[model samples]
Target: MKVNGKVIVVTGAGSGMGRALSLQLIKEGARVAGIDINEEGLRETRDLTGKASAAMSTHVVDITDRERVEALPAELIALHGAVDGIINNAGIIQPFVPIKDLAYDRIERIFNINLYGTLYMVKSFLPALLERPEAHIVNISSMGGFIPFPGQSFYGASKAAVKLLTEGLYAELKDSNVKVTVVHPGAVNTNITKNSNVEMRSDVSAEEQASMTLSAEKAAEIILNGMKADKYRVMVGKDARFLDLFYRFSPKRAVDFITKKMAQMAKAS
Candidate 1:
C-alpha cells in the first residue's frame, strides 16, 4: 500500500533503520507514530524531523511489555485517527559467542525482544490494521535468519521465527486487505552492537565495514519500495541477495563459507 497520508507505526524509531524509515515515511507524506524504549533517542528522532516533526508522534514504550504494547493501538488511533501499517523494526543481537558459551538469561532476552516483541505488536495492531481499507505489516528479519552466523545462532533463530511468522501471516491475510512483507537485511551500517549492549569483536577497519554494509537510509528506501509494491519478501543488500541464492544452491557450502568468514574475523580481532 502507498504510505502517503497513512498513519504508520514504526518500532525502534529511536535510531538505525527505524529512524531512517520514519524520516522517509514523513517525506513521502505519511504520518508516523515512532515507538522506542529510549525516550531520548525518540526525542532526537523528532528533533531531526524539524517542521515536519508535527507529522510524527513519538512513543516511549518497550515492545516486550505486553500491557504497554496492547495500549498502543488506542493511543495511536487517538492521535492519528487511524492505523494503516506497522513495521516491526526493533531487535537486538546476542553476544558474539558460541551458543554453548551463551547464558540462558541472554538467550531469553534475545527471544523476548526479537520474537515475542514482534509477535505482540502484530497481535495488538492487527485488529486496528484490519479496520483500514488497506493495511500492511513489515517485519525485519536478517540475513542470519535464513543462514547461520556462527556466533549469533540464537539471534538468527529468533529472526528465523519472525521470517516464518511473517510468511504465515501473509498466507492467512492474502484474501484480506492487509499485506505482509518479511525483510532480510544483510549488514547495514547502524549501532546495533552498542544499542544491543553487546561488544562486537571485529578487527575490520571502519572503511572496510562501511564498504561491506548498506547504509541505514538506503536500506529503509529499499524496504519502503518493497512495501509499496506489496512484495512478500525483500532482500535489503547485495550480500543478502547473493547469499540467499547461494544458500538455496548449496546449504552446506554456504554454511561452511560463513563459518570460515567467522573464524577469520575472530582470529583478526
Candidate 2:
C-alpha cells in the first residue's frame, strides 16, 4: 500500500524501530498517530518529526489493557476523521532464564505486551481498515520466533505467536483489501535490552554489541519496504536472514550450535 497521505497508527512509537518508522512515515507524507506507554518517549518521537502538525500525533497507552487498546481507534478517528492502518510493534523481552526457572510474572508480562497486545490492536482497528479499499497491518515478530534460543524462550514464544497470528490473518484476509505483514529482526541496536531485564549469553561486549547490531533506522526501512511489497514474511538484517535459513536447514544442529557458542562465550567472559 502507498504510505503517502495514509492515516497510520503505530504502537510502541515512542522509541527504537517504532520511533524511526513514525518519523519515516511522516517524511513520506503519511499522517501518523504514535502510541506508547512511555509518554516521555512519545514526546521525544514527536520532537524528531519535521512538521509540528502534519501527520503527527502521540498517545500514551498500554497495549495489554484491552479497554485502552479498543479506545485507540475511537480516539484517532475523533481527531483524524478516519483510520487506514495499524503497526503492531510494541513488544517486551523477559530476562534470560530457563523456562522451568522463569518467573511467572515475567513470562506473563512478555506475552501481555508482545502477543496479546498485537492481537488486541489488530482486532480493534481491523473493522475500520476493511472499510477502505486497500489497508495494511504490520506485525513485528523476531528472529528468535523462527528459532528459539535457550535463555530467551519466553520472548521467542511470544514472537512465535505473532508469526502464526500474522500468517493466519493473511490467509483469512486473502480475499479482502487488508494486507498483513510480519517482520523478523535480529539484534538491532536499540534500548530493548536495557528496558528489560534480559541478558545476552553471546559474550558480546557492550562496544561489540554497539558495532554489530543493525540500526533502528535500517530496520524501519526494511519493514516499510516489505509492507509496501505486501510480503507475508519479512526478514531484516544479515543475522536475521541467517537464523531463518539455519533454523530451517537443521533445527537441532542450529540450537546445539547456539547453546555451545553461548556457553563458551559466558565461560570465557
Candidate 3:
C-alpha cells in the first residue's frame, strides 16, 4: 500500500524505530497518528518533525489497556478523518536472566506489552482498516523471535508468538483489502534497554554496539519500503536477513551458534 496521503497509526512512536517511522511517513506525505505512553517523547518527536508536524498527531495511550486501545480508532478518525494502516511497534525486553530465574510477573509484563499489545491494536483497528480501499498492518518481531538468545528466552517466546499471530493474520486477510506484514529486526541502536529497564547481558562497548546494530532511521526506511511494496515479511538489517536464511536452512546449527555466543556474553557480564 502506498503511504502517500494515507493516515497511518504507529505505536511506540515516542522513541526508537517508531519515532523514525513517524518522521519518515510524514516526509512521504502521509498523515501519522503517533501513540506512546511517554508524553514527553511524543512531544520531542513532534518537535523534531518541524513543519511536517502538522500532519502528525501524538496520542499518549498505553497499548496494553484494552479499553484505551479499542477507543483509539475513534480518536484517530476525529483527528485524521480516516485510518489506512497501523504499525504495532511497541515492545519491551525481559531481564537478562535464565528462564529458571525469571519471575512470572516479569514474563507476564513482557507478553502483555509485546504480544497482547499488538493483538489489541490489530483487533481494535481491523474494522477501520478493512473499510479503507487499501490498508496495511505492520508488526515488528525480532531476530530473537526466530533465533533464540540464551538470556532472552521469554522475550523471544513473546515475539515468536507475535510472528505467528501476524502470519496467521496475513493468511486470514489475504483476500481482504488489508495487508499484513511481520518484521524481524536484528539489533538496532535504540533506547529499548533503557526503556525496558533491563540490564544488558554484556556491557557492549560503543564500537561493538555500532558494528552490530542498524540505526533506527535505517531500519525505519527499510520497514516503510517493505510496507509500500506490500511485502508479507520484512527483515531489517543484513544480520536479520542472514540469520533468517541461516535458521531456515539449519535450525539446529543456528540455535547452537547463538547459544554459544550468548553464553559467552553472559559469562563475561
Candidate 4:
C-alpha cells in the first residue's frame, strides 16, 4: 500500500533505522507516530523532523510492556484520527558470546524485546489495521535469522521467530486488506550494540567495518520501497540478499562459512 497520506506507527524511532524510517515516511506524505523507550532520543528524532515535525508524534514507549503496547492503538488513533500501518523495527542483539555462556536474563530480555514485543504490537493494532481500507505490517528480522552467526545464536533465534511469525501472519491475512512484510537486514551501521547495552569488541579494521555494513538511511529507503510494493519479504543490504540465496542452496555450507568468519573475528578480537 502507498504510504502517501497514511498514518504509520514506527517502533524504535529514537535512532538508527527507525529514526530514518520515520523521516522517510514523513517525506512520503505520511504521518508518523514514532515510538521509542528513550525520551531524549525521541526528542532528538522529533527535532530532526524540521518543518515536517508537524507530521510526526513521538511516544516514549517500551514495546515489551504488554499493557503499554496494548494501549498504543487507541492512543495513536486518538492522536492521528486513524492508524494505517505499523513497522516493528525495535529489537536488540544478544551479547557476543556462546549460548552456553549467556545468562538466562539476557536470553529472556532478547526474546522479550525482539519476539514478544513484535507479537504484542501485531495483536494490539491488527484490529485497527483491519478496519482500514488498506493497511500494512512490517517486521524487521535479521540476516542472522536465517544464517547462523556463532556468537549471536540467541539473537538469531529470536529474529528467526520474527521471520516465521511475520510469514504466518501473511498467510492468515492473505485475503484481507492488511498486508504483511518481513525484512531481513544484513549488518547495518547503527548503535544497536549500545542500545542493547552490550559492549562489542572487534579487531576488524575500520575499513572492513565500513565495507560490510549498509547505512541506516539507505536501509530505511529499501524497506519503504518494499512496503509500497506490498512485498511479502524484503531483504536489506547485498549481504542479506546473497545469503538468502546461498543459505537456501546449501544450508550446511552457509553455516560453515559463518562459523569460520565468526571464528576469525573472535581470534582477531
Candidate 5:
C-alpha cells in the first residue's frame, strides 16, 4: 500500500528507525501518529519534522500496557480520521550474556516488548485496518531472529517469535485488505543498548560496529519502499540479506560462524 496520503501509525517513534520512518512518511505525504515511551524523544522527533510536523502527532504510551495499546486505534482515528497502516518498531534487546546467565525478568521483558507488543498493536488496529481500502502492518524482526547470536539468545528468540507471528498474520490476512510484512534488520546506528538498559561490552570494535550496521535513515527508506510494494518479507540491510542466504544453505555453519565471532567480540570486550 502506498503510504502517501494515508494515516500510518509508527511505534518506537521517539528515536532511531521509528523516528526516521515517521519523518519519511510525513515527507511522502502521509499523516503519522508516532507512539513511544519517551516523551522527550517524541518531542525531538516532532521537532525534527519541522514544517511537516503538522502531518504528524506524537503519542507517549508504553506499548506493553494492553489497555494503552488497545486504546490507540480510537485515539489515532480521532486525530487522523482513520488508520491505514501500522509499523511495530518498538522493541528491546536482552543483555549481552548467555541464556544461563540471563535473568527471567529480562527474558519476560524482551518477549513482552518484541513479541507481545507487536501482537498488541496488530490485534488492536486490525479491525480498523480491515475497514480501510488498503492497509498494512510491518513488524521489525532482526537478523538475529534467524541467525544464532550466542550472547543474545533470548533476544533472538523473541524476534524469531515475531518473525513467525508476522508470517502467520500474512497468511491469515491474504484475502483481506490489511497487508502484513515482517522485516529483518541487521545492526543499525541506534541507542537500543541504552534504551534497553543493557551495557555494551567495551571490547566491541568500531570497525565491527560500522561493518554490520546501516544508517537509520537508509534503513527507514528500504523498509518504507518494501511496505509500499506490499512485500511479505523485507530485509533492511545487505548484512541481513547476506546472512539470511548464508543461514539457509548452511545452518550449522552459520551458527558456528556467528558463535565464534560473538565469542571473539566478547573476549575482546
Candidate 6:
C-alpha cells in the first residue's frame, strides 16, 4: 500500500483522477504501468510521471477488451518481474440520462467498461497477486455509487457494483496480505462529461465547471494516503464524505437531497 517502490498497474490513466494518481504514485517512488484508451492521455500522464522511456511507464490499452486484460499480468510481470498492485480505474459515464431515455447500447458500453472492465482486471491479476506476500487493489467508484443522481442511473449502477465488489474483496482478503480499497469521489474538476458520451442534466457554466468541485490532484493524494492506511472506503471530497454519512444514517434523506438538487438544476436551466 505504500506508494514508494511499489510496482502498480493503473488503468484509465489518461485523465481525471486516474492521471493524477499515476503522477502522484510515481513521484512517491512507485514504478507505475499506466494504461488508457486514450493514448494521448497516456502520453500526458507519462510526461507527468517523468520524461523517460523507462521500464515502468505508460501505455494505451482498453480495459473493456477481455483478451487484452487477461494478458496484462503476464506482460506486466515480464516487464517488472512482479505485480504488486492493480488500480481498476478504467471507467465510462456515458448517456447521463434517465434510464427510460438512455439507449441500450450506451448502457451496455458503460457497464462493459465500468463494471466488467474492473472485474476483468481483478480476475486477470488476482492469481498473480495471490503469489505476492503483500499486494493491493484500488478501485475507483463514484459518489453516484453511494448516492443517487437523476441523470446518471446507469453510471451509478455500474460503480455501485464496483463499490460492493471492492468491499467483498476486502472481506475475503481480511487475513491475507492483499488489500482492497474502493474510492468514491465527488464532483472533481475533470472533463469527464466532455470525454464521456453521457448527457449532462444541465450544462455547467464555463467558469463553474472549469473550477471543478474537486481537484484531481487533491483527490489522488487522498486516495493514495487512504490506500496506505488500508481504508475500506475512501470518500475523496467533503461531498463524498457527507453523502456517505447520509446514506448510512438517513438513506431517504439522501434520495430527497438528490431529487431536490435535480429540481433546482431543472429550474436553473
lDDT of 6 by residue, 4-56 (tens): 77799998788888888888887788888998889888887787655543635
- Relative to the true structure, how large is the alpha-carbon lDDT of every model? 0.96, 0.88, 0.94, 0.95, 0.92, 0.85
In candidate 3, which residue ranges exceed 4 Å CA deviation?
201-203
lDDT string, candidate 1, 73-97, tens digits: 9999998899999999999998998
Best by TM-score: 1
The deviation in Å at residue 76 for candidate 6 is 0.7
Q: For model 5, what is the error of residue 82's alpha carbon versus the real structure, in angstroms, after optimal superposition? A: 0.2
| Residue pairs clashing, model 6 | 94-198, 95-198, 96-198, 96-199
Ranking 1 against 4 by TM-score, winner = 1
Off by over 4 Å in 5: 203-212
Residue-wise lDDT of candidate 3 within 1-269, one digit each (tens)?
99999999999999999999999999999999999999999999999999887999999998999999999999899878999999999999988889999999999999999999999999999999999999999999999898898879999999999999999999999999999999999989999998999876567787888788899999999999999999999999888898999999999999998888877877787
Candidate closer to the true structure by lDDT (higher is better), 1 or 3: 1
Model 3 — TM-score against the truth? 0.97
Candidate 1 regions with alpha-carbon error over 4 angstroms = none
- Regions of candidate 2 where Cα sits further than 4 Å from its true position: 199-206
What clash count does candidate 6 reach? 4
TM-score of 5: 0.97
**Model 4: CA > 4 A from native:** 205-208
Candidate 4: deviation at residue 85, Å?
Answer: 0.2
Question: What lDDT does model 6 reach?
Answer: 0.85
Model 5: per-residue Cα lDDT over 1-269, one tens digit each = 99889999999999999999999999999999999999999999999999888998999999999999999899889888999999999999988888899889999999999999999999999999999999999999999999979888999999999999999999999999989999999989888998999988675577767666898999999999999999999998888998999999999999898888877877777
lDDT of 2 by residue, 64-181 (tens): 9999989888889999988888898888788766899988988899999999999999999999899987999999999988887877899999999999999999999988999999
Model 4: weakest 10-residue lDDT segment is 203-212
Per-model TM-score versus the true fold: 0.99, 0.95, 0.97, 0.98, 0.97, 0.94
